[model samples]
Target: MQSLKEGLLNRAFSHIYVEKRAMEYELTKEILKRFKESKVIEIEHYKDIFSRANQDFYLQKKSPKLILAVKQNNLIYKGADVCEDFGNKHFYYTSIMMNCIYDCEYCYLQGMYTSANIVIFVNLDDYFKEINRLLSMHPLYLCISYDTDLLALEGLTNYVKKFIEFAKENSDLTIEIRTKSANFNLIKHIQPQDNIILAWTLSPEGVIQKYEHRTPNLKRRIKSIKEALDRGFRVRLCFDPILYIKNWRDEYRDLIEEVFSNIDADKIYDVSIGLFRVSKDYLKRMRKQRPDSIVLNFPYDTVEGVCSYDKELSRNMIGYVYGLIARYVEKEKIYI
Candidate 1:
């Protein structure tokens, strides 16, 4: 079978740009009419669909499968550390959307959701109100792009800019927009907020070419990051899910040097590091769905439901990268 890139964007309706208030049902109807023969996975009726360990998203992640875009529900978790530690702080994260625009084979979304259909929770005010209520007690560090790359879908959903505006008013809240998108146009519209940190996930050029699928290349991402930093955005680097590839050391060394060479290290807020990892349940589904994926086929050790490189390899990779990064960034700014 040909790669998804063969004609990923050829089907015009595959990516429908809609206004924020456009009813998801109406959008679904429009999509279904456009691709009447395609499958539709109705997610509004399928609550807790992603929580299922054995869910197969590839079956439903396609045209006409309109996952109802609902308001982000409850649970304002602020007690889990999201930055440097595995699980340390009370930083909170809430998902305003589900699924992503890019189709990265290594992404856990395929295993986490039963539908590939994008779901945009139209009720943004509800989340803002909820955060306000939570902020009554403690300052919150909210991860807005944890579940979806809001930047990539900015043309359809202007959530990030809205969130930035929201943060400009709510100075007590720390908002992080983590993304793999090269959509710098969206970031340009809004002024950089002191509390809003733009986090970009970086991978070596080879790794991105081999596994990242529709996401922007490393150079594009770096260019975007540099632009944001130059414009005074509090930028964070995420060297995450570091894959152990052939001559990975040389590749990553070059990547690190290349990154620091382009951007001002002093202006950077911090750098986050994490080895490749995913739930074993998610891995099983992806492996079966994409048997040809080298990322899935690689040997991984399972701890509970999470599958990652063996402990030794994971440690060595992080340690080596940490040492390489220490040369450019301060010890305090590095998070592992």
Candidate 2:
């Protein structure tokens, strides 16, 4: 978590650009109060700066600016084919924010967006209205934190708390809030809801230290998960996007063992596993952006438009991990 002096970032922003229309929002006023040190520039629209060309993503990432805007349309979207649905037919995702605070080497966002600046949509009431409309149609499975870590930014946004309240009011809506953050205390006071699945992406310590930059350590994350379970929240463990780091087999093996050692597999809602996979276009851009990154430079095989490790390696990795997890968790409870 960022300290009070750091305000919005570890690479703290010097300026926060607010949309002319967004200034009236309660969230905007609340955030501005915290960052009195920053220069608050009012803009006609967020994209005037957010989508501009020739912006240096690497340099911007070091001290990214924050943009407060009102999201105009397409409040909800069908889940991409590349994303795992976990057996839900109505799988969908919505982004209240544009970028993440942590910078993982294999992150698809680097290839997906041109700028690294963080953009927050202040019109969250609109998002809730859209979800309410969709819920009328049928039961919905929504990924609320798809593009950004809402939990990590909860200190500034209070978005996760709002979502927890929204989920409680609508039982038919199943929401998945995935993150690498260890900031569970932000919402620990709220009563846990069965429809809200809190997911933490678990990587080996070596893997986290090497690539998952600026995120919490393994020990801290496990401690948070334990607290969540003790507080009666249904927690999900995600070993998804298993990277091919050196001695990865030993690393992941110990990771699985360490997790089950402290966490009761029965108490865990479920486990999710998957190998690193990205779009061909995203991989191409990532290779260009991070030419020196070891993870990005792997000679992955392309199946259709997606790039990933060869089928043999993927199968071996997943199968091996599956066996280890199955020792603790039921096979049916695991999602590949």
Candidate 3:
């Protein structure tokens, strides 16, 4: 067990809710040991609290309680169309953790979930068991960290480190751990695996400050990417959900240049780009949660149950950003 560090909020878990059946799991015991100062209460099930009526997701975000429970079903799921597949036929994702510590307004998790508390499913072994069973069918492209930032909570859970080791043992399974946390040092000593892709989401400093709350600044994330590359890890840069804020062109142009200037584009696995788009249901919930947020309050056009900037604007924005990045990275290595 590695020595645990403080959370991104610079505070320990004040209160931790543990499921009755989950207490015996090794992962649960490891987490409990890390946060000895937290108040632990055993519960029958996670949904009893996680699904309570009107949990005020926005207010609870200021100080979200931690929930450790056993994931009884749906250990893994097929990738959704809203998410980019990068043309992989065997794409899938698993949510070992629910909700994120960082509160980015553009994040779809806010609108998807009714509660804001953090839930870490301590049944990762079951996940791997199911994945290995499916691997017998064919190769897999797995997104290990979906709807949560495992890297940011690494100090408290160390789940990312565990996933890296699993990927190392199974070369047939390709795993992508996308994150905004600059916590690469936690696993710097571990050998890098070819199947493990470290995908980092990047935005301009100004945009990060104004919209991406509680996330590391552009410089810190880029520095971490450089370190990961220097350590021979396969790195990927995600410019998805490109916010349509004022001066977006200048912001993204400079962001791309800054990324290529510090990162060797040739060494990166691939770069992905997408404009901000949300499901109709999520957008409705987001409007109620953040009535005044410029990111969510935009009068986006709806098409086929999804909402986003108009088609022409989306094309231009994606085109301009792609043009800038193409100069640094080969077009074949880029994903729309």
Q: Rate the local accuracy (lDDT) of all candidates.
A: 0.76, 0.92, 0.89
Across 36-80, the per-residue lDDT of candidate 3 in tens digits comes to 988899899998888898877777777688899999899889999
TM for every model, in the order presented, reads 0.84, 0.96, 0.95
Spell out the clash pairs found in candidate 3: none
Clashing pairs in 2: none
- List residue ranges in candidate 1 displaced over 4 A: 1-68, 75-88
- RMSD value for candidate 1: 4.6
- Candidate 1 lDDT over residue span 1-336, tens digit each: 346644452442344333333344443344446556544443333344434455445544433233445554573554432235323244778887778877777888787665576666666777889999988887778888877898887766678888899999987888888999998767686788799999999999998888887789999999999889888899999999788899999999999999999988999999998887888888887888788888888999988768889988988999999999999999888888
C-alpha lDDT (0 to 100) for residue 307 of candidate 1: 88
* Model 2, span 1-336: residue lDDT tens: 435434544445678999999999999999999999999999999989998988767657768899999999999999998788989999999999999988888899888898889999999999999999999999999998989999999999999999999999999999999989999999999999999999999999998998888899999999999999999998989998898888989999999999999998899999999899999999998888788999999999999999999989999999999999999999998999
Candidate 1, position 138, lDDT:
75
Q: After superposition, how far is residue 133 of candidate 2 from its true place, in Å?
A: 0.7
Question: Which ranges in model 2 have alpha carbons more than 4 Å from their true place?
Answer: 1-11
